[model samples]
Target chain A: MTTQEPTNAENWAKPVDSLHIAHDLPDHAINLNVEGKRVASMTSGFGKMWQKTYRVRLDGARVAPQQVVKVWKEHFPEFWQKGQHFFGPMASISPGDVALINVKTGGVKLSTGILVLYADDVSFSFMTPEGHMFTGMITFSARELEDGVTQAEIVALVRAQDPIYELGMMTMGSGAEDRQWLHVLRSLAAHFGVEGKPTLEKICVDRKRQWKRFGNVRRSAAIRTVFYSVTRPLRRKEKTRASA
Target chain B: MDFSADVRQIDGLAVIDLHGEIMAGADDALTSGFVRATTGNTGPVLLNFADVSYINSTGIALIVGLLAEARASDRRILVSGLTDHYKDIFEITRISDFVTMCDDEESAAAAAKA
Candidate 1:
């Protein structure tokens, strides 16, 4: 993160910053669940860490890696699964931009956000905030295959922040995540008018859950967002004041 | 583009001296360095990043993969020579929670010995 060091590294990643204080939401984003939370990485969560990769082959497409990525970044939200919304800043993909997200896992509606951890011509990555369901980084990349085709991929290195998320993932939650990213890749491929069958690979990086981080459950976005939603009437004034 | 790892063992601990930036292309060198360090040694591994100049998010993921490999075999990995800034990255990523940090190789090795 040092400016004096490798320019390549600095170009790829922004200086690490933790979100400690709440900030006023932009007109495009919601303020719940993300304010006052720090960015959570793989090590911050309570569950066993996992490395999941979901990829699709954009066969018959003649797009270069950089071009695919350009389109991906420019229309990032368009590729997401239905019911999932990503609200980024007005500017294009760059280091340090935050994305306000509203997503659904199975039937549960969750509000959360992510930080743009790294970006370049061919790939970009997002890291979750502390209260988010997945605490780690998910990288999206478009690369040229050996056959001159483009392959769009999503690699998620994450751990569930708390027991709630871990349990949810164990049940239908994991599949939901898988489906979400698969849908994204397919949508990206469809943009090129190519049919894609995204493949998935998942690995458990660590099996022992850190019991010490059990307290993270208190910050679970699912619970917090639900609380925020149900009690909207009570906080309407505060919300209005913050906007003012 | 030029990354290297020099490994030396003390009291069954492997101390890896890393040089250059750890980014996407440093994979082979980093993984091979681990292989060399643990091929004959059974104790913990201590990474000395004093000479390392930079690391990107992908580089961080590669290290997490290494940690996963280490944990699978019951190997403890310690770290030393992380700049305050890089140390903060480790903390933000939560890798610090698993790996013990020491100011220098001597302490990391001794801690491993303990």
Candidate 2:
């Protein structure tokens, strides 16, 4: 690596002042907790850190890694499980793009977003903004195995962003996350006309929690989204009265 | 080129010389290198990336995993020889917060001794 000629220079997103969603989203896409938020890396979260990987071999598909990645990037949201909405930009997934997500988990609808941290022919990654359920980077990629099978994989290095999320992670949130990625891989494999059984590996990278980050609860998107929903009727009445 | 890691002791610091592109395939080399570097040494471990060609997002996650391990063991970490681009990356990923970034091997060794 040299100062004048950095390798893979075009593959990374330029450093940003803060995250900003530039794309127009659907009418129902609750666009909160993303704009003006700084990306929350694994270090910034409050809970124990974990590295979870989900993988599935596309058996008999015979697709190259780059081809799989290209298809995945082009149809990114279609592979996600139902009820989890990802609104990517009109263009393909690229470095610096901000994507909105509306997901219903345990009967609560939460809206959050991710910054496209890096992208290349074989892989792309998303980093969560502050107030997301987890602070982390999720990378999706494909690689060729020894037997010439292309394996699609998702690796997430994450930690719960607040105490409430930490509690959820300890209960049902972690398992739900696992299932979500598994569904994605299965969908991707099915797209190539193959039946794929995904495998998972979880590693507890750090057991200690950062107690100092307890204040992050104030920025929780779940709490904010719930409040927004609860006060919608009042907001509608206020609008009607003002118009009259 | 394939990824490789070499560990050397400099002024009691374990300096890991890293070469080649760092991606998902480099996991074994990186982990084994860290283990060898910190096995008996109580001082800081320095990762010298002077010869590294490229690092993807997966590579960055591997470094974060290493940082987590170092913190868990109460050990210090030092990084040296990253290009300007990766220096920015280290900042963006917040890895610079936990590890001391040095410009070259000599200063890193001096700091390790100090």
Candidate 2 per-residue C-alpha lDDT over B20-112 given as tens digits, one digit per residue, 9 for 90 to 100? 999988999999999999987788999999999889999999998998888878888989999999988887776787889899988888877
Candidate 2 TM-score, C-alpha based: 0.95
Chain A TM-score of prediction number 2:
0.97
- For every candidate, the chain B TM-score is 0.95, 0.96
Q: Residues A162-192, candidate 1: write the lDDT tens digits.
A: 9999999998789999998999888888999
**Native A-B contact fraction in model 2:** 0.47
**What is candidate 1's lDDT per residue for B30-99, written digit by digit as tens?**
9999999999677889988988888877788889888877876878999998876677667766688779
Alpha carbon deviation, residue A7, candidate 1 (Å): 2.3
lDDT of 2 by residue, A1-244 (tens): 3475566778888887688989888898889899898887667789999999999999999899999999999999999988899999876999989999998765568999998889999999999888999988999999999898999999999999999999988988888889889999999999999999999999999998988889999999999999998998999999999999
Cα displacement (Å) at residue A242, model 2: 1.4
What is candidate 1's TM-score against the reference?
0.84
